[model samples]
Target: MTDVVSEPTTVTGVDTPPASPARGRWDADEHGWFGDFGGRWIPEALVAALEELTVAWKDAMADESFLAELDAVGREYAGLPSPLYEAKALSEKAGVRVLLKREDLLHTGAHKIRNVLGQALLTKRMGKKRVIAETGAGQHGVASATAAAFFGLDCTVYMGAVDTRRQALNVARMRLLGAEVIPVESGSATLKDAINEAMRDWVASVDETAYLFGTAAGPHPFPSLVQSFTRGIGDEARAQCLERYGRLPDAVAACVGGGSNAIGLFTAFLDDPDVAVWGFEAGGDGVDTDRHAATIVGGGAGVLHGSRTMILADSDGQTVESHSVSAGLDYPGVGPQHAHLAATGRASYEAVTDTEAMDALALLARTEGIIPAIESAHAIAGALRIGPRLAAEHGPDALLLVNLSGRGDKDMVTATRWFGLDPETATTDPVGDPDSDPRA
Candidate 1:
């Protein structure tokens, strides 16, 4: 990869706090460097586009009319302020107080809708007629297509061929929403490859097309931009905890692929020294194995997908393919801001194996009747493993907030196969005993 290195510079108005708690030392600098990570590392062809987007985003954030419109659209169309629920059954089983930020209940059934809606609105403000995006598990693709249709903008999404098959339902959903779905067959045929194709398209069509990056990774403005849009996940959860339970959660957790949802939920609690932040990365088998996507836990610093961050790279600095059962978490690199967070000891990250995540998924489905996306299941698994220890130290009152990043409707195929469910009969006695009390 071509590395773009630059000296750090001071950020001015860009550091303005959102509606949530002040970021304090967590804000990115002027050139978008969040400590040693985050910067515009791309071919010279895309520099102008990034610069333009940076200015446009800053301007839009300053405009009250634009802000109001984004808020209105989010509430009326994309479902903002998703409710927070105490997962009583889950808490009882885990031996800790578990509260779920129900992003899965949002309009598009994921936190991705928030970012897409904001970017789509910005696209319109920039007079772009079309938008292009890259997706892994397809939540972002579905959200982008939904936003494009709502805004009367043409949309095209690039997805990995492997993911296209695994997430075929989402591909159909995107097509139904009027998006052109392109299956990328290059380089491991995963999220990174899709991003490569999207960046190429963006470079060629910079004038009339805006690249609505799905994650809080990529170059300068994107990481910051995506965070600004999705930070509501944490902001709302923080307030909900205060109003409902009379205090903030003792700890917060989310899955980290490209780190958007994790960053979104972590932003509001970053300044709260008492609240511990945790990120769970996909561990296909284990971090000790070659097959995994635990970037923060297993990778080193390198440039990938336009930002210098923690990535799975070889001794020669070549990109290494990452693996995970959940397509959303099968990425080799993480968001630059996440790298900074990990480096500064602001957040702790761990790897959750596929078996662990799948078990957590089943547990949630059985106990709480909530089937979370496999990506989110990683967070659940991590929380379950750590919850009891935390409870031991802090007593039963220790509260853990988990971001249910997406629903599992799109993952039924994978789930069915994993659990060996009878697809023909649509019933199985695999997980629990059928002879026992049905509800028990």
Candidate 2:
């Protein structure tokens, strides 16, 4: 962050070479469209605020002081430049050297902190005394709350009632961090609904409140803005890979919920054609079933949450309810950039079943002694699924860096039920057994 990376400028009309093919067409055009995906689609009243946010973000990106401040907060407060860990046992299973970007080890136990802190700084720059966001899995809500606490800003988070129940620990954690967590019960009682509620609140309070978007999926500036904050994941990973492996990774894998983490990693390597990029979506029961959050795989191009992108929708254009056991990935729409990537073949998108993600989660915990968020487990599962192919393409020493977006402590309850583990069931070993039944 010492030197900020500016967004790609639209070189249309009299464009000479189209912004160098190697650097990727990631910059939003003058209209803010990423290959016809991103745009500003909110009410007229919010236009001034959105434009103001965009200008502030662009100014901040161009400012050295802002970049240095962000870097300082990331390293000193968020424990950033999180290490790249080589998972030996996992590599054995995948037939490649599987490297994991250890964002799970970050200060808030998640990569969400990076973007939250950046946006929080923007809030201060805007002279806002309050911040707001909507979260599905609670990782973002927790991050927003933590940043608000640090800046002494009043924070409000909107979460679906269902997420409130599923991610109860995160709810408690957010409350403890001094955030007002409101549970939205409208619509499917999930993330999309919570987003609706949050937007409504933002429209009413934009003058004094900054809606710190949780993902890269929202309107124009957000997709680019969030990616700007998170590209550090790929920035650090790419450097570490070169230093460790003497070259770029053969592939990079990251889970796609609203597509922030995947875009974060993919941006660094988009210019490297040799390094394959994979984005895994939550398959829920399976993509073949009615339940899944496989936006790119099973969805069509549409607008949702203000941006034109691939979305889970019916024939009438109503957003369908997406299902994923991992609360983090249960979204109907993805970031516009991801849609563009999949459409243009810059990146591959696939779905991993809930069972597969869970298995991968357990495998990583047992092998690397690192428990990963179920959202990240989708990426782990994806690497396991595609590693052999990469080896065939790149050789036995093929490398893939998986973005471990967050720690699994927030998902223990779901894991306990999934694996039928009884907390009361004592094991002869210190590590409790997942198969042991307390009733026995």
Candidate 3:
């Protein structure tokens, strides 16, 4: 166990796509997860307003008209409820059962679509003509832009200069979707800076713009909002698991960047208690070093991004540099609900190192033929640890569910180069950081 932050707390192979193709129907009335978790913990100026918006969201989920509109948009435009697939080879290899909630197969190749779709629908209802968001990995930006295009709304995405260069293809994707991407060059020129710039923009233009955030952190309504849209993951997994295994999985696992995917999958099992839940954090090198975003394991309670949560910070409350192989999980703070769950000891948190995640990535590629995003590979790595434990402690037939948040297509350049495989030269084991900006 490590200090500073505080103490806290599977495998398969398959030729699964980055995300599953949208399928199945969603029960809109199952908003209990969002109702209990998402709430406004912001400035008084935004509190009552957020409350009203929550009321509308609740009403919308219940309104057959609103459900029909969302369903229509999902099918013809947004593509809702991506598939859940069983990782047969990988599960057999792991000596335990494993299933994947394929969010990567969405239109944008990530779970970001679930959130953006919900936010976009809410924006239209609020009569907002413009939407602004902040992104670290660019998945959110692409998803937001996709939603904006579908809704005919103007979208602006704030990204760190560093991330823009590292994820250049995503920048192009956002632009192609007709969203203006602003690269922030201030501060560390990474995620935190982009977030700061987005806050400034939101404060200045709060009247006609809705800030569609990317994760389950931030203030109230956001954790709730994003979760509402994302619960489709768990809902699908439950039925799929039952269909495949004849019972619920013994455990559910997902990578926790801002805790969106993990929360989405874990929400349904919160009351079950018997269905164990695990959230994996980025252990860049190791939690022993200051080179990870394992907030609940290596950080402390603090206010960040408009909410009280565990944040990686220095003694003076200034955020510290967080390092992780996955750009998506390299943030210093996490969602408030994760912080709450970690505190209450209802769930467990652990760290997955860069090497472990990479190994998991390779194993999946070779065994199941599915290439996972590096961020999600962390969860796969953690599942490897869980699978063996459950197989031994429970039974040889213990079932495990892993949320594959996104695909590896966006990360191939980095992954190939990180593992010393040169895509251009067709040489395996190439070296050096793949994120070096060609024009920098």
Query: Candidate 2's C-alpha lDDT?
Result: 0.87
Judge candidate 3 at residue 9 and give its lDDT. 12
Task: Pick out the ten consecutive residues of candidate 1 with the lowest summed lDDT.
Answer: 1-10
What tens digits encode model 2's per-residue C-alpha lDDT throughout 291-402?
Answer: 9999999999998988999999999999999999899999999999999888878789999999999988887887778889999999999999999998888777888899
Q: Taking the tens digit of each residue's C-alpha lDDT, what string does model 1 give over 1-440?
A: 01212212221333333334333468788798999999989999999999999999989989999999999998988778898998887887668999999999999899999999999999999999999999998989999999999999999999999889878899999999999999999988888999999999998999999999999999998999999898999988877877667666889999999999999999987766667899999999999999999999999999998899999999999899998989889899999999999998889999999999998899888888899999999999988988998799888889999999999988888898888786575554775543222246
Against the true structure, what is each candidate's TM-score? 0.93, 0.91, 0.86
Scored by TM-score, the top model is 1
* Model 1: pairs clashing at backbone N, Cα or C within 3 Å: none
lDDT (tens digit, per residue) of candidate 3 on 248-310: 678899999898888788776564446778999999999999899999999997778777788
Candidate 1 Cα deviation (angstroms), residue 440:
3.6
* Overall lDDT per candidate, in order of appearance: 0.89, 0.87, 0.78
Best by lDDT: 1
Give the Cα-based TM-score of candidate 2 against the true structure: 0.91
